[model samples]
Target: MFPQSTQSPPTSLQVHPVPFLANTQDADELGAGSVEVPSWQIPDLVVECPKRPGARIHKGTSLILPEAGGDLLACIVRSLPVLLQIRPRWILGYSMAVDGVSLRTMYRQLEHSGPCVMIVEDSSNCIFGAFLSEGLRPVSQCYGTHECFVFRTPRLAGAWRTEVYGRSVAPTSPSQIEGASVPKPESEGASPPAGFSGQKAKYFEALRKAQAPSSSASVFCNHMGIVVGTDGPALFIDQDLLRGASWPSVGFGSPSLCTAGTDFVVRNIEARQNRFGIGAPNANERPVK
Candidate 1:
């Protein structure tokens, strides 16, 4: 999966860390523009559904999107009260142990920023979005079917971090957004990334190396993990999210997402589908301003 960033202004989700993915280092043309600032908060809703024993989260799930959303953040902000009200014993002390860039640097990148997107998975799997910033958006990207530690670190590379505890949201299909209604004709983005220039062969090579588990998950995290919210979200990425093709080398799990729980807290999360008032995820629809 080729990780992507929302170029235009964000929609329901606020792209925190305001600069998006800013590049601190300067290099030759090839390296100069490589670092993409993240802007949009890839939107996803929390539902109240029954939880099975193992890695399955999509069974008997209900659709939940907030209605009466005026702006992008409003849609996201709308859900906070609901989640807090339920308060189903949040997963605390979430630790991401995957090896990658230092937490110090990551903190600095996010400190004093708006909303930021954290791509936890490597290039092979679907990209996951985690908000690790100080800003507030009602809705947040939750994990579906993956075993990993995704904490809410709003100020990465900073002196301190505020963390949220919770059971991961299971992998959900994009079509499930509105819950049983005829899904939208398309997601927010109507077109692929502009200029859309890249090497398909090399991209495949990255994918091949990504799934191996032996390879660095950061590549996948940097490459395609951000857009893995759904099949369509994965499609927005560079690699094929569905093919499940093996990377040339073994892929480590989500690189950016540090998993820690050596001191694990096993929370028994009751499966509940959240009926958010919002409609479908405007995957293709974005704010122009």
Candidate 2:
């Protein structure tokens, strides 16, 4: 049975700006080369890593993303909300290798109320993660905003693709959600109105389905561990932080983060927080509300 939380859920949604944007100047400078740099390779704008004699990898200092699989992290960053386009200093919040394999340790290390990026590398070498609106902790009810998203970098060789899935925002008006207008009632058995037909009808149907309301329970954290979606959670990490499962979810509408079916063995996991200001609390220090 899944463990539950005793703490009451927050009454209202708490939205926060996530620092994931890259400065245009930095992006231009980093992209200078004979070959154009992929969107995933956009260097971290906040850090100034000294150029090594023959370093081929381009990344920020103190980043937990590995050189070989850093593309996954980049993809997640690129898929963040527009307001969080600028990248900020990323401080390591937790690592299975350094902090031990306990969910409690991860919660303790990420006590601050700030945005975080959690990356998980499964045994099959599949890389995926979530752009969390807040740090990980055990909470009573569902939390997070539409800004939260889950992403996965396909492991296909010679292919650079990142699939990102996020919560669908409900439209306030009918016009906001585009779909073919319903035909007026036909006179008894009169010739059915020639509305959309063939491919056009299919297109409108697909569009309407895509705009349908999704589950609001984007995230649920309790004593058991973390679940990313309420309707068949897209991702679930156990309290031991050793095993996990992933599948398509209605909350984010994301496919399995790992290609190897629904279950996966955790290989390595890390959480990184983007520092806001000099006065901002570090991973070890809980922010003063």
Candidate 3:
């Protein structure tokens, strides 16, 4: 989970521009008094990199790949939308770690050698982190092929307000809590009583009925799924169901062949009822079509 806080920036990385936006707010109502951003008040879980202890992969931290290898840049690019949604004051940028990726070598080549310069500019779409600099000059003439990338996040304003504004006049059920995933105990040790064996005279007779899901398809919140395969003519599927359903639920873009498996989420969609031909990841679900 990505953590959110205005406490301070990461020390190892450098965040420039000292962002104009403050607090998490949608494009709209973000700067009006104070914007309401998505759930960024809670910080991401602290990743304990047992292999790389020195590296603290915390939320809002910059991560530099040794080089532009695999899908590192693409993974980083996805965060831009999240940042715009969160609208944090700043974002830290990291230097690619050596001996980690081939991308690190690319950075070195660009930083030192060559006659690289800006040749064209697609100014129509103002994307985030899209900057072309020569000796730190972000002008149109300062960009070129493979020399730079559009990295600046597009700035949106007034995009989150709804047509219906005022609070509901009628009371609503306390069913859904907006930002609470942690559950509370109903009573002291409110779980099943602990014991492997029972005393004599305790008549043990239990009967339970077994049945399949009420429907051919079942939808679960935060349900896990696996990539059965690409959606092309020649598709491939995975045996391991996916863990991050949200990542794919939006839509599967140009999936890359990388160290990490490609993921796609089908909403209100199940592996069974295989008429759609979607494959299930395990014995519980159906096979790929």
Candidate 4:
């Protein structure tokens, strides 16, 4: 009211009030009009780490896996499924040094349902472990999904060499040979029939297919300990939890985990579980392999 301007207000200088804070409806309208950008398309995606440069992502101290340098831990995390790639707070569920060397005790400590990583450091200093789909328990029948896998980390100077062995996909089943024609055997020391060699190859191929282990034999546990394979266990931890064995297995198709030999003396064993919920399956529900 100080001075009434005779000139018309500038048409180009219209004053539009701007909101300092958007209401829920305004936010919703903005979001409805926006398009989500793909993560890969974004440049310089920054991953915030702890303030300390040399600090570890896993909070607690670990024996087999070093806390300061997370090379081995990174390998294990990379091997995990996509759903489990979330930043994890690894809680030590069981440690042989702290919890005592008892398989039953280990089972008790890991009774709750969730995926866990079992690490074993043998006498030769070779590090190996298995990613269990569910908590460790004594089950009469083989129980576990194909998510179970074995891994071995060989000690190398200034580097971590990790070998991961996944479940085997058996070859296609051989055709029905029940009523198939069989090649007649020739006289001893005489040349075989014209098509005998071909038939022999087919016979051996069929035999090998029959011997391959099924996917259902993923994991088995009893009163003794845990077994990874039915035919020849890729990894086995005894009741004492002091000794273990590894061998070439048709189940996981893994080579011997222990560098020393098939049997290995457990130096230190550590079982770690994610603190955050992983949406693991219930005990009653057997996941299809």
Candidate 5:
């Protein structure tokens, strides 16, 4: 089983933090570049899937990517523009745990930027993910606010779901409950953060209240626990709203990527810069601009 992030991004799910697994052979070359940042790599792993897989279930199970998605994972990596500034560490499966040493290393590298992508497969066989742009932290601290994007592939829309939460249309108190949705902050007469407008403002406002120290029901108040009416630290992706003509055919858990040949199943993910290319990963080159 994989590990879950001890920390999480605001309103998004906890992620698995894959620390930079340094190869002794490449130790000397790691010193190059202006930042001296260690390139994040996905070490290989052996995975086991049930005779019949279930949706959103990761207990003792590893996921397999579909054959059509040969380039899908690559496409997903390339789709993120922020990868240019900060590196990415993928967390496979929500329930997986990461070691303290690795988490510390990731923190030193990610300090204030980058993303941790959460990958999981649902009962429907569709892949789902949460990209926490701000990265992870100790669950005790208030998870910082950054771009949170959710996506699912092989759907009608090609564009991934960027934002999902909205402020209640009416003025309500911060403490009031409105169905299964997270409560609103405008009820407390608070203004949205600077530079946030439209749905983005509304979304963050509600998130702020849910995580506020004053709120007894704060979702993030307790480290690594889920609250009712509050989606676990996950970034919500509305399948209906995210659909657009420009969306891609990307998804989580592909059978092809999960298997090497007929006999063996994939043990771990191999991070790639070029999804279409064959061979070792390009260690020196940053693929996206």
Candidate 6:
């Protein structure tokens, strides 16, 4: 059985800012030759509850898909069993069209404080994501290999498929979280800082070489996704999935990859914090009462 929390889930949670706005200044610093920066801003991604009409999921959340009404909702509903496995207390950020930079930025903001759920879509619009237990960290920081829960609801399928990926390790400290949350520093065209090399730097270097695709060489690939999303992606946290079953493997990457049975729950979305910035909501729109 899942361990009960003596403390109630917090009423509010923080929503990591979606870094979709292009940072041309930093791009130039990295010698990004001729990469056109966008002058206009995109719409804010928001999450809403259909059951609670017009109810803002959490202020500063990404945009809700009004047209994604039926099948999508049904898919989420069917995922209840899987969602309950990991009772996420807070809602981070949700997007319909997400890129590698945006995903990395959110992780940097998280600073490996907790776990998160990332929903991905492919060229074919196949929908899936993983329950990142240890948050986003470097592959070298990982022990052996980290583990994450994966789920999928194919465009044509009605039910969802549950699986696990033990390809990532857990974070050692809260500070280990990268600074990708900010666009400028990450794009400054510098090498990984001191004491962050060997397997980790090599792994991250591969990502830099890949030019930041939807899925890079990091363990984020297992949790974030391998297939890029056609539309902005959605992300958040779910409750721990392994309740009755013993933890599939011990140590960060001991058994490496293990799988647990699939069962599911009703999900609750709570407000965390809203990021303040150029593309975010005005100051007045923040700290919703």
Q: TM-scores across all candidates?
A: 0.20, 0.59, 0.18, 0.59, 0.33, 0.31
Segments of candidate 1 deviating more than 4 angstroms:
1-70, 84-194, 200-220, 223-226, 230-289
Using lDDT as the yardstick, the better of models 1 and 2 is 2
Model 1 CA lDDT for position 82: 37
Query: Where in model 6 is the C-alpha error above 4 Å?
Result: 1-90, 94-103, 143-147, 158-289
Per-residue accuracy of model 3 over 77-109 as CA lDDT, tens digit each: 222333222222211111222112222322332
- lDDT: worst 10-residue window of model 1: 262-271
TM-score of model 6 (CA atoms): 0.31
| RMSD of model 2 against the true structure | 16.3
129-230 per-residue lDDT for model 6 (tens digits): 544554544343222112333434334333322222223343343232232211112346664333332443353334333432222213323342221111
User: Candidate 4, residues 158-246: lDDT per residue as tens digits?
Assistant: 23345676766642332322111122235433333232245433432233234434552366666666766544456777667777777
| Model 4, runs deviating above 4 Å | 1-62, 67-69, 156-160, 171-212, 277-289
Write down the worst ten-residue block by lDDT for model 5.
244-253
lDDT: worst 10-residue window of model 4: 13-22
Q: Can you tell me which runs of candidate 2 are displaced by over 4 Å?
A: 1-64, 68-70, 169-214, 277-289
Put the candidates in TM-score order, highest first: 2, 4, 5, 6, 1, 3
Candidate 3 vs candidate 5: the TM-score winner is: 5
Across 1-289, the per-residue lDDT of candidate 5 in tens digits comes to 1233477422322111221122132212322321211223111221211211231424554344322132234334433444332333332222222211132333333333334544434333334444444454335534433243344343222332111221112223432322222223455565432222346436434554445332222222132221111222222222121211111101111111101111111122111111212244334322220
Q: Write the per-residue lDDT of candidate 2 for residues 177-238, one digit (tens) a residue.
A: 32212221344333222422343334323323433344333676766777775444567787
Clashes (backbone N, CA, C under 3 Å), per candidate, total 92, 5, 39, 0, 29, 37
Q: Evaluate model 5: give its TM-score.
A: 0.33
In order, what lDDT does every prediction score? 0.24, 0.54, 0.19, 0.53, 0.28, 0.29
Scored against the true structure, residue 53 in model 3 reaches a CA lDDT of 32
